[model samples]
Target: MYRFTGSWLHKALVRLCASLLAILGLKLSAFYFLGLLIVLGLHREQLLG
Candidate 1:
């Protein structure tokens, strides 16, 4: 019974960590893309005006 519970807890912990990492990765990528877009816009304005 203890072993079964331990295994279950381990699985849950792994799943939690994986989900957290996935969320972090998504947020980082989104921020990076947004920054790139803003930089491009600024560069275009500088070139045009």
Candidate 2:
């Protein structure tokens, strides 16, 4: 029983870590895309001006 509990705990921790990493990766990608969009917009305005 103790061994089973330990295995469960290990699996839970791994799942938690994986979820956190996926969320962080998505957030970083979103921020990067947003920054690129802003820079592109600014350049477009400058070109028009």
Candidate 3:
């Protein structure tokens, strides 16, 4: 019974960590995309002017 509970807890913890990492990764990618867009806009303006 104790071993079963331990395994359940471990699985829950792993799932929690995976979700947290996924959220962090999504945020990082969003920021990266925003920065890329900003840079591209500036480059476009420079080329036009």
Error of 2 at 30 (Å): 0.4
Candidate numbers sorted by TM-score from highest down: 1, 2, 3
lDDT of 1 by residue, 1-49 (tens): 9999999999999999999999999999999999999999999999999
lDDT of 3 at 16: 100
Q: In terms of TM-score, which candidate is stronger, 1 or 3?
A: 1
Over the stretch 1-49, how does candidate 3's per-residue lDDT look in tens digits? 9999999999999999999999999999999999999999999999999
The 10 consecutive residues of candidate 3 with the worst lDDT sum are 1-10
Q: What lDDT tens digits, residue by residue, belong to model 2 across residues 1-49?
A: 9999999999999999999999999999999999999999999999999
What is the total number of backbone clashes in candidate 2? 0
How far residue 36's Cα lies from its native spot in candidate 1, in Å, is: 0.4
lDDT of each: 1.00, 1.00, 1.00
Residue 33 deviation, candidate 3, in Å? Answer: 0.5
TM-score of model number 1 = 0.96
Model 3 Cα displacement at 32 (Å)? 0.3
